[model samples]
Target: KFEQANGGTILLDEISEMDQGLQAKLLRVLQEQQVERVGGRKIINLDVRILATTNRKLEEYVAENKFREDLYYRLNVFPLQWLPLRERIADIVPLAQRLLAKYSRKMNRTAVSMSDEAQRVLQAHPWPGNVRELDNIIQRSLILQQGALIGPGDLHIQPGSMHTAEMAGRINSVGVSQADNSQLGNDMKQHEFQLIVDTLRETGGSRKDAADKLGISPRTLRYKLAKMREAGIDLDAELKG
Candidate 1:
Protein backbone atom coordinates (compact mmCIF):
# COMPACT_ATOMS: atom_id res chain seq x y z
CA LYS A 1 0.00 0.00 0.00
CA PHE A 2 2.92 2.37 0.78
CA GLU A 3 4.41 1.53 -2.60
CA GLN A 4 1.07 2.24 -4.23
CA ALA A 5 0.84 5.55 -2.40
CA ASN A 6 4.45 6.39 -3.19
CA GLY A 7 3.90 10.07 -3.83
CA GLY A 8 0.83 10.42 -1.66
CA THR A 9 0.13 10.53 2.10
CA ILE A 10 -0.65 7.70 4.51
CA LEU A 11 -2.36 8.74 7.75
CA LEU A 12 -1.98 6.63 10.85
CA ASP A 13 -4.71 7.77 13.19
CA GLU A 14 -4.36 7.03 16.91
CA ILE A 15 -0.74 6.07 16.61
CA SER A 16 -0.52 5.69 20.40
CA GLU A 17 -2.71 2.59 20.19
CA MET A 18 -0.13 0.74 18.09
CA ASP A 19 1.63 -2.01 20.05
CA GLN A 20 5.38 -1.98 20.73
CA GLY A 21 6.14 -4.77 18.26
CA LEU A 22 4.11 -3.04 15.56
CA GLN A 23 5.84 0.23 16.48
CA ALA A 24 9.23 -1.39 16.00
CA LYS A 25 8.13 -2.76 12.63
CA LEU A 26 6.87 0.68 11.61
CA LEU A 27 10.10 2.30 12.72
CA ARG A 28 12.09 -0.17 10.57
CA VAL A 29 9.84 0.55 7.58
CA LEU A 30 10.25 4.33 8.03
CA GLN A 31 13.99 4.13 8.51
CA GLU A 32 14.68 1.69 5.68
CA GLN A 33 12.12 3.14 3.20
CA GLN A 34 11.57 -0.40 1.97
CA VAL A 35 9.25 -3.28 2.75
CA GLU A 36 9.28 -7.02 2.16
CA ARG A 37 5.93 -8.62 1.61
CA VAL A 38 5.16 -11.81 3.50
CA GLY A 39 6.47 -14.93 1.70
CA GLY A 40 8.07 -12.63 -0.93
CA ARG A 41 11.83 -12.19 -1.23
CA LYS A 42 11.94 -8.95 -3.19
CA ILE A 43 12.03 -5.71 -1.14
CA ILE A 44 9.97 -2.83 -2.57
CA ASN A 45 11.24 0.70 -2.05
CA LEU A 46 8.66 3.21 -0.73
CA ASP A 47 8.41 7.00 -1.22
CA VAL A 48 5.27 7.68 0.72
CA ARG A 49 4.66 10.59 3.09
CA ILE A 50 3.50 9.50 6.56
CA LEU A 51 1.19 11.50 8.82
CA ALA A 52 0.02 10.37 12.24
CA THR A 53 -2.33 11.63 14.94
CA THR A 54 -2.66 10.74 18.59
CA ASN A 55 -5.01 12.10 21.25
CA ARG A 56 -2.66 11.23 24.06
CA LYS A 57 0.55 13.03 24.99
CA LEU A 58 3.30 11.00 23.30
CA GLU A 59 6.01 12.68 25.38
CA GLU A 60 4.39 11.26 28.51
CA TYR A 61 4.20 7.86 26.82
CA VAL A 62 7.88 8.16 25.96
CA ALA A 63 8.80 9.06 29.55
CA GLU A 64 6.81 6.05 30.77
CA ASN A 65 8.68 3.86 28.27
CA LYS A 66 5.33 2.78 26.77
CA PHE A 67 6.36 4.15 23.36
CA ARG A 68 9.67 3.55 21.69
CA GLU A 69 11.85 6.70 21.91
CA ASP A 70 13.51 6.02 18.57
CA LEU A 71 10.14 5.52 16.81
CA TYR A 72 8.72 8.63 18.44
CA TYR A 73 11.60 10.77 17.21
CA ARG A 74 11.19 9.47 13.66
CA LEU A 75 7.44 10.20 13.57
CA ASN A 76 7.56 13.49 15.48
CA VAL A 77 9.52 15.37 12.84
CA PHE A 78 6.66 17.87 12.54
CA PRO A 79 3.86 17.92 15.07
CA LEU A 80 0.60 19.84 15.15
CA GLN A 81 -1.63 19.72 18.19
CA TRP A 82 -5.32 20.33 17.83
CA LEU A 83 -7.18 22.24 20.51
CA PRO A 84 -10.25 20.46 21.89
CA LEU A 85 -13.70 21.64 20.82
CA ARG A 86 -14.31 23.48 24.09
CA GLU A 87 -11.26 25.59 23.39
CA ARG A 88 -12.15 26.25 19.75
CA ILE A 89 -15.52 27.90 20.32
CA ALA A 90 -15.51 29.69 16.97
CA ASP A 91 -15.48 26.43 15.01
CA ILE A 92 -18.47 24.76 16.70
CA VAL A 93 -21.30 26.38 14.73
CA PRO A 94 -19.66 26.18 11.30
CA LEU A 95 -18.65 22.57 11.88
CA ALA A 96 -22.14 21.68 13.09
CA GLN A 97 -23.81 23.35 10.10
CA ARG A 98 -21.49 21.57 7.67
CA LEU A 99 -22.17 18.20 9.28
CA LEU A 100 -25.90 18.92 9.32
CA ALA A 101 -25.86 19.61 5.60
CA LYS A 102 -23.84 16.45 4.94
CA TYR A 103 -26.07 14.11 6.97
CA SER A 104 -29.23 15.79 5.66
CA ARG A 105 -28.30 14.94 2.05
CA LYS A 106 -27.09 11.47 3.03
CA MET A 107 -30.33 10.69 4.88
CA ASN A 108 -32.42 12.14 2.02
CA ARG A 109 -33.99 14.69 4.30
CA THR A 110 -34.96 18.21 3.36
CA ALA A 111 -32.24 20.79 3.84
CA VAL A 112 -32.56 21.36 7.55
CA SER A 113 -31.63 24.80 8.80
CA MET A 114 -30.50 25.46 12.34
CA SER A 115 -32.40 27.77 14.64
CA ASP A 116 -30.48 30.40 16.60
CA GLU A 117 -31.45 28.61 19.80
CA ALA A 118 -30.10 25.34 18.47
CA GLN A 119 -26.88 27.04 17.52
CA ARG A 120 -26.61 28.41 21.04
CA VAL A 121 -27.13 24.96 22.55
CA LEU A 122 -24.48 23.50 20.26
CA GLN A 123 -22.02 26.29 21.06
CA ALA A 124 -22.52 25.69 24.78
CA HIS A 125 -21.44 22.07 24.54
CA PRO A 126 -17.91 21.09 25.63
CA TRP A 127 -17.64 18.41 22.92
CA PRO A 128 -15.61 15.79 24.76
CA GLY A 129 -15.97 13.58 21.69
CA ASN A 130 -14.87 16.50 19.47
CA VAL A 131 -15.82 16.42 15.77
CA ARG A 132 -17.07 12.83 16.02
CA GLU A 133 -19.46 13.86 18.77
CA LEU A 134 -20.71 16.83 16.77
CA ASP A 135 -21.24 14.54 13.78
CA ASN A 136 -23.31 12.11 15.86
CA ILE A 137 -25.42 14.91 17.39
CA ILE A 138 -26.24 16.33 13.97
CA GLN A 139 -27.13 12.87 12.58
CA ARG A 140 -29.35 12.08 15.56
CA SER A 141 -31.09 15.46 15.43
CA LEU A 142 -31.74 15.02 11.71
CA ILE A 143 -33.33 11.67 12.48
CA LEU A 144 -35.47 13.00 15.33
CA GLN A 145 -36.49 16.42 14.09
CA GLN A 146 -39.64 16.76 11.97
CA GLY A 147 -39.34 20.36 10.82
CA ALA A 148 -37.29 22.36 8.30
CA LEU A 149 -35.76 24.26 11.20
CA ILE A 150 -33.76 22.50 13.93
CA GLY A 151 -34.27 24.09 17.35
CA PRO A 152 -32.85 23.58 20.82
CA GLY A 153 -35.65 21.12 21.62
CA ASP A 154 -34.52 18.92 18.72
CA LEU A 155 -31.02 18.46 20.15
CA HIS A 156 -30.26 15.83 22.79
CA ILE A 157 -26.99 17.10 24.21
CA GLN A 158 -25.43 15.10 27.00
CA PRO A 159 -23.93 17.00 29.93
CA GLY A 160 -20.15 17.09 29.65
CA SER A 161 -17.20 18.35 31.70
CA MET A 162 -17.95 21.96 30.76
CA HIS A 163 -21.64 21.52 31.50
CA THR A 164 -21.26 21.90 35.23
CA ALA A 165 -23.89 22.79 37.81
CA GLU A 166 -23.18 26.45 37.20
CA MET A 167 -23.65 25.91 33.47
CA ALA A 168 -26.95 24.16 34.14
CA GLY A 169 -28.03 27.14 36.19
CA ARG A 170 -27.02 29.44 33.36
CA ILE A 171 -28.94 27.35 30.86
CA ASN A 172 -32.01 27.54 33.09
CA SER A 173 -31.59 31.27 33.34
CA VAL A 174 -31.85 31.40 29.54
CA GLY A 175 -35.26 29.61 29.68
CA VAL A 176 -33.91 26.23 28.57
CA SER A 177 -35.24 23.60 30.90
CA GLN A 178 -33.70 20.15 31.01
CA ALA A 179 -36.27 17.40 30.81
CA ASP A 180 -36.61 14.68 33.37
CA ASN A 181 -35.60 11.30 31.98
CA SER A 182 -39.11 9.88 32.51
CA GLN A 183 -40.81 12.69 30.51
CA LEU A 184 -38.26 12.96 27.69
CA GLY A 185 -39.91 10.39 25.41
CA ASN A 186 -43.38 11.89 25.69
CA ASP A 187 -42.04 15.42 25.26
CA MET A 188 -40.13 14.42 22.11
CA LYS A 189 -43.21 12.79 20.61
CA GLN A 190 -45.25 15.92 21.27
CA HIS A 191 -42.57 18.09 19.66
CA GLU A 192 -42.42 15.80 16.63
CA PHE A 193 -46.20 15.86 16.21
CA GLN A 194 -46.36 19.63 16.52
CA LEU A 195 -43.52 20.05 14.01
CA ILE A 196 -45.31 17.81 11.50
CA VAL A 197 -48.57 19.77 11.89
CA ASP A 198 -46.80 23.11 11.57
CA THR A 199 -45.04 22.00 8.39
CA LEU A 200 -48.30 20.74 6.90
CA ARG A 201 -49.95 24.07 7.70
CA GLU A 202 -47.07 26.02 6.20
CA THR A 203 -47.26 23.98 2.95
CA GLY A 204 -51.08 24.36 2.76
CA GLY A 205 -51.76 20.65 3.40
CA SER A 206 -49.45 19.47 0.59
CA ARG A 207 -48.11 16.22 2.08
CA LYS A 208 -45.09 15.96 -0.26
CA ASP A 209 -43.92 19.49 0.44
CA ALA A 210 -44.62 19.02 4.13
CA ALA A 211 -42.66 15.79 4.14
CA ASP A 212 -39.79 17.51 2.41
CA LYS A 213 -39.83 20.26 5.01
CA LEU A 214 -40.15 17.74 7.83
CA GLY A 215 -37.24 15.62 6.58
CA ILE A 216 -39.49 12.59 6.26
CA SER A 217 -40.88 10.61 3.34
CA PRO A 218 -44.34 11.37 1.89
CA ARG A 219 -45.34 7.82 2.78
CA THR A 220 -44.21 8.41 6.34
CA LEU A 221 -46.27 11.59 6.47
CA ARG A 222 -49.32 9.65 5.22
CA TYR A 223 -48.85 6.96 7.85
CA LYS A 224 -48.49 9.59 10.56
CA LEU A 225 -51.59 11.43 9.32
CA ALA A 226 -53.47 8.15 9.34
CA LYS A 227 -52.41 7.52 12.94
CA MET A 228 -53.39 11.07 13.89
CA ARG A 229 -56.82 10.58 12.31
CA GLU A 230 -57.26 7.37 14.28
CA ALA A 231 -56.29 9.30 17.41
CA GLY A 232 -58.99 11.96 16.63
CA ILE A 233 -56.40 14.66 15.88
CA ASP A 234 -58.60 15.86 12.93
CA LEU A 235 -55.61 16.93 10.81
CA ASP A 236 -57.70 16.70 7.63
CA ALA A 237 -60.28 19.16 8.92
CA GLU A 238 -57.59 21.51 10.19
CA LEU A 239 -55.62 21.35 6.94
CA LYS A 240 -58.60 21.71 4.61
CA GLY A 241 -58.48 24.89 2.46
Candidate 2:
Protein backbone atom coordinates (compact mmCIF):
# COMPACT_ATOMS: atom_id res chain seq x y z
CA LYS A 1 0.00 0.00 0.00
CA PHE A 2 3.06 2.25 -0.47
CA GLU A 3 1.89 3.93 -3.73
CA GLN A 4 -1.63 4.23 -2.32
CA ALA A 5 -0.49 6.38 0.61
CA ASN A 6 2.91 7.65 -0.69
CA GLY A 7 3.63 8.03 -4.42
CA GLY A 8 6.69 6.04 -5.57
CA THR A 9 8.18 4.25 -8.59
CA ILE A 10 9.84 0.85 -9.05
CA LEU A 11 12.55 0.20 -11.64
CA LEU A 12 12.99 -3.25 -13.15
CA ASP A 13 16.37 -3.37 -14.96
CA GLU A 14 17.24 -6.22 -17.36
CA ILE A 15 13.53 -7.07 -17.40
CA SER A 16 13.85 -9.44 -20.41
CA GLU A 17 15.25 -12.07 -18.07
CA MET A 18 11.97 -12.19 -16.10
CA ASP A 19 10.24 -15.60 -16.35
CA GLN A 20 6.73 -16.31 -17.78
CA GLY A 21 5.27 -17.46 -14.47
CA LEU A 22 6.56 -14.30 -12.78
CA GLN A 23 5.21 -12.20 -15.65
CA ALA A 24 1.73 -13.66 -15.17
CA LYS A 25 1.96 -13.01 -11.46
CA LEU A 26 3.20 -9.44 -12.14
CA LEU A 27 0.35 -8.85 -14.61
CA ARG A 28 -2.14 -9.53 -11.83
CA VAL A 29 -0.35 -7.03 -9.55
CA LEU A 30 -0.31 -4.39 -12.29
CA GLN A 31 -4.02 -4.70 -13.13
CA GLU A 32 -5.14 -5.29 -9.58
CA GLN A 33 -3.66 -3.63 -6.46
CA GLN A 34 -3.86 -6.97 -4.69
CA VAL A 35 -0.66 -8.86 -3.85
CA GLU A 36 -0.94 -12.57 -3.06
CA ARG A 37 2.43 -13.88 -1.91
CA VAL A 38 3.55 -17.43 -2.76
CA GLY A 39 1.42 -19.94 -0.81
CA GLY A 40 -0.10 -17.08 1.25
CA ARG A 41 -3.85 -17.10 2.11
CA LYS A 42 -4.44 -13.34 2.53
CA ILE A 43 -4.10 -10.99 -0.46
CA ILE A 44 -1.91 -8.03 0.64
CA ASN A 45 -2.92 -4.71 -0.89
CA LEU A 46 -0.28 -2.56 -2.71
CA ASP A 47 -0.25 0.31 -5.25
CA VAL A 48 2.97 0.13 -7.35
CA ARG A 49 4.01 1.77 -10.64
CA ILE A 50 6.62 -0.10 -12.68
CA LEU A 51 9.26 1.19 -15.11
CA ALA A 52 10.90 -1.71 -16.92
CA THR A 53 14.09 -1.37 -18.97
CA THR A 54 15.96 -3.86 -21.15
CA ASN A 55 18.78 -3.76 -23.71
CA ARG A 56 17.25 -6.66 -25.73
CA LYS A 57 14.28 -6.47 -28.08
CA LEU A 58 11.62 -8.03 -25.83
CA GLU A 59 9.01 -8.23 -28.64
CA GLU A 60 11.29 -10.34 -30.86
CA TYR A 61 12.19 -12.55 -27.90
CA VAL A 62 8.49 -12.97 -27.07
CA ALA A 63 7.73 -13.99 -30.69
CA GLU A 64 10.56 -16.58 -30.52
CA ASN A 65 9.13 -18.03 -27.25
CA LYS A 66 12.07 -16.63 -25.28
CA PHE A 67 9.91 -14.02 -23.47
CA ARG A 68 6.27 -13.70 -22.38
CA GLU A 69 4.01 -11.87 -24.87
CA ASP A 70 1.64 -10.42 -22.28
CA LEU A 71 4.50 -9.03 -20.18
CA TYR A 72 6.23 -7.56 -23.23
CA TYR A 73 3.09 -5.66 -24.31
CA ARG A 74 2.42 -4.51 -20.76
CA LEU A 75 5.92 -2.99 -20.28
CA ASN A 76 6.28 -1.66 -23.84
CA VAL A 77 3.55 0.92 -23.22
CA PHE A 78 6.04 3.82 -23.63
CA PRO A 79 9.38 2.60 -24.99
CA LEU A 80 12.30 4.73 -26.14
CA GLN A 81 15.13 3.10 -28.07
CA TRP A 82 18.49 4.91 -27.81
CA LEU A 83 20.56 5.09 -31.00
CA PRO A 84 23.97 3.40 -31.25
CA LEU A 85 27.17 5.51 -31.14
CA ARG A 86 27.97 4.96 -34.86
CA GLU A 87 24.76 6.69 -36.00
CA ARG A 88 25.70 9.82 -33.95
CA ILE A 89 29.26 10.69 -34.93
CA ALA A 90 28.98 14.38 -33.96
CA ASP A 91 28.68 13.46 -30.27
CA ILE A 92 31.85 11.31 -30.24
CA VAL A 93 34.40 14.12 -29.85
CA PRO A 94 32.38 15.87 -27.11
CA LEU A 95 31.76 12.53 -25.39
CA ALA A 96 35.48 11.70 -25.60
CA GLN A 97 36.46 15.10 -24.16
CA ARG A 98 33.98 14.71 -21.28
CA LEU A 99 35.29 11.20 -20.61
CA LEU A 100 38.88 12.41 -20.76
CA ALA A 101 38.14 15.10 -18.18
CA LYS A 102 36.30 12.60 -15.94
CA TYR A 103 39.20 10.13 -16.09
CA SER A 104 41.75 12.88 -15.52
CA ARG A 105 39.99 13.98 -12.32
CA LYS A 106 39.54 10.39 -11.10
CA MET A 107 43.22 9.51 -11.73
CA ASN A 108 44.43 12.84 -10.23
CA ARG A 109 46.02 13.73 -13.56
CA THR A 110 45.66 16.83 -15.78
CA ALA A 111 46.15 17.99 -19.41
CA VAL A 112 45.23 14.50 -20.79
CA SER A 113 43.74 15.60 -24.11
CA MET A 114 43.12 13.84 -27.44
CA SER A 115 45.25 14.88 -30.43
CA ASP A 116 43.61 15.71 -33.81
CA GLU A 117 44.70 12.34 -35.28
CA ALA A 118 43.29 10.49 -32.21
CA GLN A 119 39.92 12.30 -32.62
CA ARG A 120 39.82 11.26 -36.29
CA VAL A 121 40.58 7.63 -35.35
CA LEU A 122 37.81 7.63 -32.71
CA GLN A 123 35.32 9.10 -35.17
CA ALA A 124 36.15 6.55 -37.92
CA HIS A 125 36.13 3.40 -35.75
CA PRO A 126 32.72 1.66 -35.68
CA TRP A 127 31.92 1.22 -31.98
CA PRO A 128 30.10 -2.12 -32.12
CA GLY A 129 29.92 -2.43 -28.33
CA ASN A 130 28.83 1.25 -28.33
CA VAL A 131 29.33 3.58 -25.35
CA ARG A 132 30.69 0.80 -23.13
CA GLU A 133 33.46 -0.09 -25.61
CA LEU A 134 34.36 3.59 -26.15
CA ASP A 135 34.55 4.12 -22.39
CA ASN A 136 36.89 1.15 -22.02
CA ILE A 137 39.14 2.27 -24.90
CA ILE A 138 39.37 5.78 -23.40
CA GLN A 139 40.21 4.30 -19.99
CA ARG A 140 42.96 2.15 -21.51
CA SER A 141 44.40 5.07 -23.50
CA LEU A 142 44.37 7.28 -20.42
CA ILE A 143 46.28 4.65 -18.43
CA LEU A 144 48.84 4.10 -21.23
CA GLN A 145 49.28 7.78 -22.13
CA GLN A 146 52.41 9.47 -20.69
CA GLY A 147 52.35 12.81 -22.54
CA ALA A 148 49.75 15.63 -22.24
CA LEU A 149 48.04 14.72 -25.55
CA ILE A 150 46.76 11.25 -26.54
CA GLY A 151 47.37 10.38 -30.23
CA PRO A 152 46.14 7.49 -32.39
CA GLY A 153 49.11 5.49 -31.08
CA ASP A 154 47.85 5.95 -27.48
CA LEU A 155 44.34 4.84 -28.56
CA HIS A 156 45.93 1.84 -30.41
CA ILE A 157 43.09 1.77 -32.97
CA GLN A 158 44.02 1.40 -36.66
CA PRO A 159 42.56 3.62 -39.43
CA GLY A 160 39.90 1.05 -40.34
CA SER A 161 38.97 -0.87 -37.19
CA MET A 162 37.56 -4.36 -37.71
CA HIS A 163 35.04 -6.14 -35.51
CA THR A 164 35.10 -9.90 -34.79
CA ALA A 165 31.93 -10.57 -36.81
CA GLU A 166 33.32 -8.75 -39.90
CA MET A 167 36.56 -10.79 -39.65
CA ALA A 168 34.58 -14.05 -39.27
CA GLY A 169 32.39 -13.12 -42.31
CA ARG A 170 35.53 -12.57 -44.43
CA ILE A 171 36.92 -15.97 -43.29
CA ASN A 172 33.65 -17.88 -43.92
CA SER A 173 32.92 -16.27 -47.33
CA VAL A 174 35.80 -18.16 -49.10
CA GLY A 175 34.81 -20.50 -52.02
CA VAL A 176 36.02 -23.99 -53.05
CA SER A 177 39.52 -24.41 -54.64
CA GLN A 178 40.21 -25.33 -58.38
CA ALA A 179 43.27 -27.63 -57.75
CA ASP A 180 41.42 -29.83 -55.23
CA ASN A 181 38.31 -29.70 -57.49
CA SER A 182 40.31 -31.04 -60.43
CA GLN A 183 41.89 -33.68 -58.14
CA LEU A 184 38.36 -34.72 -57.02
CA GLY A 185 37.45 -35.69 -60.61
CA ASN A 186 40.63 -37.81 -60.86
CA ASP A 187 39.89 -39.39 -57.45
CA MET A 188 36.33 -40.34 -58.60
CA LYS A 189 37.80 -42.02 -61.70
CA GLN A 190 40.32 -43.94 -59.57
CA HIS A 191 37.51 -45.02 -57.17
CA GLU A 192 35.42 -46.33 -60.07
CA PHE A 193 38.44 -48.28 -61.41
CA GLN A 194 39.09 -49.74 -57.93
CA LEU A 195 35.37 -50.68 -57.55
CA ILE A 196 35.48 -52.72 -60.82
CA VAL A 197 38.69 -54.53 -59.70
CA ASP A 198 37.20 -55.31 -56.24
CA THR A 199 33.87 -56.50 -57.73
CA LEU A 200 35.68 -58.79 -60.21
CA ARG A 201 37.87 -60.20 -57.38
CA GLU A 202 34.74 -60.88 -55.24
CA THR A 203 33.17 -62.69 -58.23
CA GLY A 204 36.26 -64.88 -58.82
CA GLY A 205 37.25 -63.05 -62.14
CA SER A 206 33.77 -63.82 -63.61
CA ARG A 207 32.85 -60.81 -65.82
CA LYS A 208 29.14 -61.73 -65.89
CA ASP A 209 28.86 -61.87 -62.06
CA ALA A 210 31.01 -58.74 -61.71
CA ALA A 211 28.74 -56.88 -64.18
CA ASP A 212 25.62 -57.91 -62.22
CA LYS A 213 27.20 -56.79 -58.87
CA LEU A 214 28.21 -53.44 -60.48
CA GLY A 215 24.67 -52.97 -61.96
CA ILE A 216 26.28 -52.65 -65.46
CA SER A 217 25.82 -54.63 -68.73
CA PRO A 218 28.53 -57.21 -69.54
CA ARG A 219 29.40 -55.16 -72.67
CA THR A 220 30.06 -51.99 -70.57
CA LEU A 221 32.08 -54.05 -68.04
CA ARG A 222 34.25 -55.41 -70.91
CA TYR A 223 34.85 -51.86 -72.18
CA LYS A 224 35.79 -50.67 -68.63
CA LEU A 225 38.28 -53.59 -68.29
CA ALA A 226 39.96 -52.57 -71.57
CA LYS A 227 40.31 -49.00 -70.31
CA MET A 228 41.76 -50.22 -66.94
CA ARG A 229 44.31 -52.38 -68.82
CA GLU A 230 45.35 -49.39 -70.98
CA ALA A 231 45.80 -47.27 -67.86
CA GLY A 232 48.37 -49.95 -66.61
CA ILE A 233 45.89 -51.10 -63.95
CA ASP A 234 46.25 -54.95 -64.03
CA LEU A 235 42.56 -55.77 -63.40
CA ASP A 236 42.90 -59.58 -63.92
CA ALA A 237 45.98 -59.96 -61.64
CA GLU A 238 44.43 -57.58 -59.08
CA LEU A 239 41.14 -59.53 -59.25
CA LYS A 240 43.10 -62.85 -58.58
CA GLY A 241 40.60 -65.64 -59.32
TM of each candidate vs. truth: 0.63, 0.51
Residue lDDT tens for model 2, 1-241: 3334325677877888888787787777777767755687787677566778788988789889988776677777888887899999999999999988986776567878888999998898888867766775676566435468998876655434433222222211222221233332443244455556655666788999876655457998888778666666655456553
How do the residues 1-241 of candidate 1 rate in per-residue lDDT, one tens digit apiece? Answer: 6767777899898999999999999999999999998899999989899999999999999999999999999999989988998899899999989988886776566758999999999888878777767775676576567579988866667566422221212111211122232432443343444555656767787889876655557898888777555555556655552
Clashes of 2: 0
Relative to the true structure, candidate 1 has a C-alpha RMSD (angstroms) of: 13.9
Off by over 4 Å in 1: 161-241
Instruction: In model 1, state the lDDT of residue 182.
Output: 40
Model 1 TM-score, all chains together:
0.63
Segments in model 2 whose C-alpha atoms lie over 4 Å from true places: 1-12, 18-51, 158-241
* Each prediction's whole-model lDDT (CA): 0.71, 0.66
